[model samples]
Target: MLRFIKFAKDALLAFPLTLIFLPFSRFFSFLYYYNKLVIWIWKNKGDVTYHDFYSPFRDYKKRYALYENILQEQKLKEESICYLEFGVASGASFKWWLEHNTNIDSHFYGFDTFEGLPEKWGSFDKGAMSYKIPEIDDSRAKFFKGLFQETLNPFIQSHEVNITSSARRIFHMDADLYSATIFSLSQLFPYLKKGDLIMFDEFSVAMHEFKAFDEFVSNFYIKLRPIAAVNNFYQICFIVE
Candidate 1:
């Protein structure tokens, strides 16, 4: 029986699976993560999460409500937070934080291409959702006008001491593509600390943000406990526990 089991495992490993499955891998990967997402939500959506499970129509505006609640609950409005936003497309959320925080010591860093996505995302073509960098008068706000791959490291190197300071850290992951999301998270992993906040803007999209997030959590073995989920987990917030 042991010999047969070993033979079966060897046969499976030896099989030229990629030749047959590579074409449909995209679809299968999506299905697999979709199911994993559902399961994750069901298991983790405990009494703690500010959840709305049966949202009929997703209102992107609800993210503002989510922002409000998280800020209020965390008492972060007046705190000096290192606000790192990966996707600052129109700067709506960025401005929202700037308006609410009221902390002069708090620094806001926005990273983006300011042109559009580097690659195609879902139905949106490459370079879709393009916007000029928003102009702001605040000296506290700094914009990195390029891909995260190009900018984050240099920023980190320059601001290492300030970022790793006792100031609160809030990382807002609005980059919609899995590749971008995963890249940002993995790069940011080493700097993550307990009680730091992380958020996902397009979290319910299983094949993209969710897939990246799932893998990131699993890979890092990081302790991230979900605090709030709005729009049926489309926009979810977690704290590094």
Candidate 2:
């Protein structure tokens, strides 16, 4: 059976048809992961107890609600927490959390290229969505300006103890690229604790953030229990279990 399967595979690739299919390999691959994404959602949607799934429209405002819902559920609004936000374009979400938490001891770190995305995301070019980092008045908040691949490791090393400290950890993964999202998750997986929170700004996008998330959870065997999902799962929050 194995021999037959191998022979069939080799014959397909050795044929002229392979050239035609090769050009559309990415298209075919997307269908596979898109189907996987839909199936996974179908099977696990019931497990997400606090979701506003299947909304008729997408509203960016619902992200704040997602944040509030999780905070109210976890009772961490005023708690001392370590908040790390990846892809802090314009710093809107970063400022929102910083203002909402009101905990002086809660350290907020925002990571981004500030110049724009490190790679192209769908229609957006490599430098699309580029914005200068917003200036915030709080001393508790700091911005790391560079690629996650370059900056994250150094930050992790310096704050290794603080990362695993008593303060609650909340990671806002707003990076829309799979490469950025996956790299950030993989790097932070070892530091993730049971109570830590992980939110994806683009969880429903099949090819990028969703792909990274599916791979991260599956590959690491990390049980991330969905807590809140808004904007048709465009913004989903999970708690490490």
- Give the true-structure RMSD of model 1: 2.1
lDDT string for model 2 (1-241, tens) is: 9999999899987775677677899999899889988897787789987888788989899899888888888888889999999999999899989988978899999999999987889899899888998888999999999999999999999988878789999999999999999999999998898989999999989999999999999999999988789987889989999
Shift of residue 150 alpha carbon in model 2, Å: 0.6
Instruction: Show the colliding residue pairs in model 2.
Output: none
Q: Write the per-residue lDDT of candidate 1 for residues 163-204, one digit (tens) a residue.
A: 898999999999899988999999999999999999999999
Q: For each candidate, what is the lDDT?
A: 0.92, 0.91
Which ten-residue region of model 2 has the weakest summed lDDT? 13-22
Clashes of each: 0, 0
The list of candidate 2 runs beyond 4 A from truth reads 8-17
